[model samples]
Target: MEPHIAFEDISKIYSNHVTTVAVEGVNFQIMPGEFISLVGRSGAGKSTLLKLLIAEERPTQGRVFFEGRDIATLDGSQEISSLRRKIGTVFQDFKLLSNKTVFENVAFAMEVAGKNDEEIAEDVPQVLELVGLSDKINNFPHELSGGEKQRVSIARALVHRPGVLVADEPTGNLDPANTFEIIRLLLKINEIGTTVVLATHNKEVINTLDRRVVSLDKGRLVKDDPRGTFIL
Candidate 1:
């Protein structure tokens, strides 16, 4: 079978007046249901790789394929939307809507996807329960703690039941205690068969995972360990 996601000799360069190479000749394949962590320091191209995967940034060379379709060639908005639906993303910032309640925040994902009210009602509660935020459904972003807000973000990301979830520095804003909570939640999500691509610089968090680790340094892939730790 084909890989779920593949990057073939991919490279990205940003230029206007000054030229900056974000990623160079990066190649990897993520299998279905695999839990993989991308480890790197700042400016190591981790974010560029994640952006390439979701087609937020186009490659300067080579191709990024999602389930065999080259993302660079995906020209239509409909196709891009379909691709995004299959890949959920979470960020360090909770990115919650201040005006909406927790339930509404999660439901908004499905709502914009054209899901019916009944489906949104059924799925929102279930996803919130998964993130341990069922009781906080009526709360808003300002009403929750850092960890709780992140949990709400995770719930919103999972509402569509995507095949792969990409988290970029998800624990950056949390305390150590809350960091572990979020990691455990991601692991649980991976356990139930969602492929997880976690991009983080946290040594303790990466060390604890003990899963596949791909290390990047200065826009190049440095190492890939099957049972890896965070080594710089």
Candidate 2:
């Protein structure tokens, strides 16, 4: 089977007052239906790699391919929109609308994607249920616990029924119990066939996952191990 995503000699360099190489000469492939942990420290290029994959930042050199298409070449707004519909992203900070309720927050994503009311009405509730937030649909982000807020974030990400889920430091703000809950949710998402690329620095989370691990250090690919542990 072909790789679901591939990074070929990827490098991203940022220039301003100072020059910073976020990533350099990185190469890896994510197979379909696989869960891979991207492990690294701060400034280790994990986030830069993700940005390249999503086309948020074009690589300074090399290519990032999603399902065999170079994402860097997706320059049109329509193309990027279509690509986003296929990849769901969850961030450490729950980027929910402060004034919107849980249901509305999830529904907003569909709305932005040009989903009609009927589609949003049907899909929002179903995704909320999938994330175990059925009863809290009316709660605001301020009213929910840290875990509940993150669940809502996950729910929003899944509402698109995306083929790939990219979660960056998803459990960064949660306590141990909530962290495990989030990890379990991610694993469950993976079990159902979504390609999950989880970029996290949590050692315990990495060790416990025991899945494919791609480690980076100082802007370079350090290791790619199947059933890997946290070894940076």
Residue-wise C-alpha lDDT for candidate 2, range 183-216, written one tens digit per residue: 9999999999999999999999999998999999
Could you say which candidate leads in lDDT?
A: 1
lDDT per residue for candidate 1 within 5-112, as digits (tens), equals 998999999998999999999999999999999999999999899999998888999999998999988978887887887888898888899999999999988987
The 0-to-1 C-alpha lDDT of every candidate, in the order given, reads 0.93, 0.92
lDDT of 1 at 177: 95
**Candidate 1 at residue 137, lDDT?**
93
Please, what is the TM-score per model?
A: 0.97, 0.96
